[model samples]
Target: MILTTKSQFQSLIFTGTNGEYIAHYSHWSLRSVFQPIFGHNNILVGLEALVRIEDVHGESIRPDLFFSSTDISIKDKVNIDKLSRVIHIRNFAISEYKNLKLFLNILPSVSEYFALSDINTCLLSNRLKELQIDRSQIVMEIVELNANNEYLFVEAIKRLSQAGYCIAIDDFGACASTIERVKSIQPDIIKLDRGLLLEHFSGESNRLLEGIKMARALGAQIIVEGIETKEHLQAMETLDLDMFQGFYLATPQPILSCISNAV
Candidate 1:
């Protein structure tokens, strides 16, 4: 990716649209939407990058539908994943909240593929260098890490950690986001899935406290997502959690739009 001139860089399928950089693939346009990650002090500490997909008619498409659709092949899924990051990186570089941490997701298949390859995180590293973003400011979140090859997955996490990028295990308490995997990864942060919060509120389990304790004792920050109510925010604060995110704090919106208005 050695670039001698701006022309070469501009040829990456990103179109300049009304002060924003968007990636185009097939008949759909990919976008980066940010959900605020708030700290204990109720300050903006980071943003979780979420994807938005739209068809040629500009009609909104569910990300889950676009991402999990069997209508698309595995190769295109990986390409869309990469392009999602590209659009996010380019957009974040031009946003006002560039100083805060930008949490980018690593697709499960891509993570597994990268782990076995020599270019593990070179693409991300090169992109950040090209954009002049500090490696520490990027959070490499591995989704569905439980599905990846265990040995190579840990190796990939180690490689990224050694490269100065903070690692996070997304969706704790769901699927196979178990303690064994947590111990194996030992990520810098562990994001609790929203279901855990629901169970806690319903008094069905005390796993929430256990999760917080687990993350704390492991020397990792705990972030609880899906805090939609005032009680939700208060309860998290009472636990002295490290970070929080959900509709109560702010909804997911495009980074370019967030700068003009308070999120």
Candidate 2:
């Protein structure tokens, strides 16, 4: 008897009828939730697409767990990343908030694949066009997890930036190598890790302030994540941070027709 759980089933890589290795998540019931990024005066400047997956039983599965449970090979990981981007763009196109910029997370490894050739560039551009999304409206947020190949990662970011996609270094301060990454990639935006806010109450603002200054010096806009409380908002009010996203301002949800439906 083959005992298969949903996580296990979703992790299995199989050869499709077309003789290509298909990522399990590509066929899974996946949807995207948009989290609004606010600028000064609480104006909505952009929306970040957060992916959600549902099990066969209709239960919500956390994305982190979904990805971590799957021992996906590098190739399949790249394929899954591409599929997720397509889904996000498709959903954004059909939604009423198509006017705002859409932020999409891309794994550094997957980005390297995109940097490999002009064909890949055209492929993504065509995909966005098919969904009526402009390439310029997409902000590629490169996730730094296991981004060991600095040379490849930097080159990939350069290629993508040249192709007109705004590059952002996601989860800054989450690791020590982030500073070097910021210097090398020179991303258009730097998102401070949510962990920094946890330390704000302890009166440790030096590091956070320094990070903001460094990003500004590099000609990058600063965005702070995880602002869930009024105190958190107060703590960040004096900073030069350009954008904010978290539970306090708004939470991730499907963009409904009316403004009152926002989370």
lDDT top scorer: 1
Q: Candidate 1's residue-wise lDDT over 162-187, tens digit each?
A: 77889898888876678787898789
Write candidate 2's Cα lDDT for 1-263 as tens digits.
12123344335445345332333453455655689888888888899987776666778777656554556456545555666666567667767778888999988766766556673345567667767777788899977575647677778789888888898888888853378878888899999888777766687877787788898888898889999999888778777579998888888876543222553
TM-score of each: 0.89, 0.83
Clashing pairs in 1: none
Model 2, runs deviating above 4 Å: 1-27, 55-59, 68-70, 119-121, 257-260
User: Could you report the Cα RMSD, in angstroms, for every candidate shown?
Assistant: 3.3, 7.1
lDDT, candidate 1, equals 0.79
Clashing pairs in 2: none
Instruction: In angstroms, give how far residue 41 of model 1 lies from its true place.
Output: 2.5
Candidate 1 segments whose C-alpha is farther than 4 A from its true place = 1-12, 116-121, 145-148
Cα error, residue 177 of model 1, in Å, equals 2.3
Scanning candidate 1 in windows of ten residues, the lowest lDDT window is: 1-10
